[model samples]
Target: MVIRGAGRLTAAAVGVAVTVATAVGLVLTPSSAKVEPAMVADPGPPEVTISIALGGATHGYVNPDVALAQGGTLTIANGDGVLHTVTSDALGTSGDPLFGFSVPARTTRSFALPSLAGGAYGFYCVFHPGMRGTLTVIGGPVGEVPAPPSFDQALRIPKVLSGDHITIPMKKADVRIMADGPKTTMWTYGGSYPGPTIERRAGQQTKVTFVHKLPKDAGSMTVHHHGGHQSSADDGQPTKHLIEKGAKRTYTYALRDAGKPAPAAFNFYHDHRMHVTARNNWRGLQGMFLITDPKEKKLGLPTGKYDVPLHFSDRSFTASNQLSDPFGHAAHSGHGGMPGWMTGEHAPPNDATVGQRILVNGQYAPYLTVKPGLYRLRLLNASLFSAYDFALSDGSAFTQVGTGSGLLPAPVTRQDVLLGPAQRADVVVDFRGKAGQDVLLSTIPRSDSTGTGSRNAALMQFRVRGTTSQKARVPGKLRPLAPLKGVPGKVSKTWTFDLSEMHSGGQHGSFWSINGKMFKASRMDHKVRMNSVEKWKLRNTSDMTHYVHLHQEQWHTLSRDGDEPPPWEQGLEDTWRLDPGEEVVVAARFTDFPGVFMLHCHMLDHEDHGMMAQFEIVR
Candidate 1:
């Protein structure tokens, strides 16, 4: 048995150039013949001059002011070897053609930007979202960006499994196909529970030696680097053709640094193992993959004594304490939790009540003992369909740390942290009360924590054990993030969606929808160029709050309908719950990697219950 190497990766300063660092065949490699260079002596890519600094030529910012006059030629220099493009959203909102000009390594091309006016233009690497730049065109005063984050040298990171982390194990579950309950099935990574946690440094390498232990019916196990960009092969797409059960495959990949002043505070990983993402993730085949880049680590933010990654989830258990995949046949589940939602293709009485009694990692009602001082609880709502307008029982405040995509430059104290399905919050809760006193955690009012049958509560009792040592204290601030650059004028398009409940068949089919319809291939959501900004609005009509989430991209929560916290909601989030009859707006940009992605409710049941939609992005 050969053990796969969790290799070391260098945080090489990136300007522009894709290095074919290493490639090991996942399953097997065939014999090949070597070829000698026939024409060139020192063969390499056609070299051109490039600006290796962050921004402009690299993944950072361009000079604050645009030097262009009227009808000046715009130059797109490719620092990264992989194919790239310079696109704009000035044409139209939907279906805008991209400026597909290829700049090989070190190459640069000039194009005309007619009638240059003062505005912000977004740029990105066609292959990687992390590689992006901001172009500010100024005929007037330009904008200013905050200073980058400063990292502390003593950030505590468990040396083992810290950077370039990998793990492999038997995937077992009662796989569901369009819902119904428990059947014999195999899973990858996180068995019938949230899978393994793969942690790594910002710039590192990892490879998984995966073996399919499924039945003869299935032979696929793919790992989806949920927050990864650049390398598409590691995206973990399952194919009909796979290594047979009992056979193994090794997947290797590198974590390229996104040259920001700060580090990516949080990211998640899960099984992209193909057609079973819904089933595998639903069957507890899910876990968190964290990246602690060196830059952020150096930030003197709260260390191990305060920071903790808390996964939140909710599950319904039977009298026997067995978790039944009630999300099967979600079509039969009520607007809340209904029966026949977890099982695959099985039917049951649609009126059955589904109450989630257990909170696993990110679940409801999980207990955690804390000290009587300030403790930063990194809460991740990894639930299938639960959202928390979370607040402390005594009405304590939570100093928010970060969102889905990354962290902000400063901390914002929040009264209630609202997390839709898949949404997360880095909150610093000060346990300043008496030690040994019991603290009760509860969900905020708007969250409707009470379930359909009664009140829904995601809280658990937290008993303070002791006081913290003075040597360890929460930092004045957490990791700072790259300043949010400006976007072009209203050149972007508009997108709208509606969420509501429906009644179908003889039973009350509990589900919501976008744009008043379910996901249909024939129906196009919206199309846009590679780099552009657009305003998206989600109108909720259902009685329950549906947290809508987007993948592969990060969006900023602009504002809610009321005086509710909008600035606090500005963290990078993949999931956000829409309270009943409330409308939320998001300022978003669709960067490189032209493809179609799914946008669904964070509530797994709501998503499987037909509350899902898809959008397309093109170059």
Candidate 2:
């Protein structure tokens, strides 16, 4: 006879009487005789089915705790559209799982539980540690269950690739973006979502080979060294040279600006395929590039593991954990469709794509454990369109030491740092006083004129623990940056950015334009004499925001709407944000290898549509 109880029976109490009666076969005599007639029509062990829940980590299992017979059949139905596993907790002296069953996405699997002394059994998803549950058996000895893991997982830092010659292959990989989410299939570089960090010295020359291994449907590709000053042949012109499937290309970087060592800065590399830049970049072809100099090491700053690079981006996933294509639907469709004026035979490019999920270094809201000390954070806004106003939840201020191009002459204390798409910032954050506290790095939402801003606010968490004896300080003076050698108010060129309608292929459609002209691949919009310093005025007439990024040389902002530039804008910058009806004057010197380079909106969706133009520096 089976007996069930909330508490286990004492061995001492049951051993003397129960053991003697069971050994003599007297315990089951009356019960077995009464059930003998019913045993002939036994219907086998009981069966129960459990479902893996949908949504996020909060909803783990449909029936988390279940009680069943000792040897019942257990079935797991996985309808979450991603692979999952039912793994028992560690048991026995060796600490191995008692039983495990693999269940694919949208499928079911069944297994019979081993007959053992009854107790509570703990189980969890192998892929997602946050998913856990308990199973209770009716009659048996009690088992010890370990506590489940927390929702926060350690942040994953990308491996660094440093060498004279580097070869990176592009392919598809399944990556886990959240601690409690399914694996997502993404096009990756070196089989990683954000690829690998490429580190190089300021004055070193490096040769990089990009091998295309993506599916044929992915089509041609191009890699743009966003802030590198290289020759035209290696500049990754969107329409000129292309890397097809099963093909490879080599790009050589001299790492010099007009025979001078390039400034040490944190930059990025990404896809630049014409008409599909947004699509390819959204799929995961992006990475961080760091340029170092020996002289900068003299400054007292954090190094090695203490210095962290945080890349911020956004993504949306389907129920099956696949990336949602922002441009896959018909332009006129009411749901997630393009603007009404964007109808055409070809797929219409999106105005902007803001995802609900915010990812830091390819993971969702990961936490970084740090010792109590000062840390240097290199922040990059790699998203396709979303801009972030970064701040710490504790309301602590950080020291801003650098901008996109390089270090600033003097450090400035800032309550928050604002970065547009393709922009970067170097800051030093002090966590010595915040030990045993958890601080969140989050974004303060700004008003979006296009109504496509990201809803996600939290970026990551910093769990402060441990002690540190290391002493490092942010120097008041870090580097020297000279002003651009150009007249203050002299405007060499005036470019107007606006949204306008154009007639093409016997149809009228809206397009983002610069200076009232759409992009033409074979056309050169402007020409400048090499080694000439010039000032340009950029005016945004449209209601939406635009991020202007220039290639080849970094520029200094002279004024914003006829007012002095902010402290963050006083340093050398490669990108600037222009609000509605705002005009910014910037000064730049066109030098180095003279060739055709691009100047366009860093909002990739706008650039892919028509907001790009080319300029040539003639010797």
Best-performing candidate as measured by lDDT = 2
Show where candidate 2 strays beyond 4 Å.
Answer: 1-151, 330-341, 344-350, 447-456, 486-489, 503-507
lDDT of 1 by residue, 58-125 (tens): 34223322334333455555443223333331211111111112233334555544332344544332
lDDT of 2 by residue, 258-369 (tens): 6888999898889998778878988999998888888887998888878999999877655455676655532354212334425432212224554435688998668999
Using TM-score, give the best candidate's number: 2
Question: All candidates' lDDT scores?
Answer: 0.46, 0.70
> What TM-score against the true fold does each predicted structure earn?
0.58, 0.73
Model 1 residue 65 CA deviation (Å) reads: 66
Clashes counted in candidate 2 amount to 3
TM-score of 1: 0.58
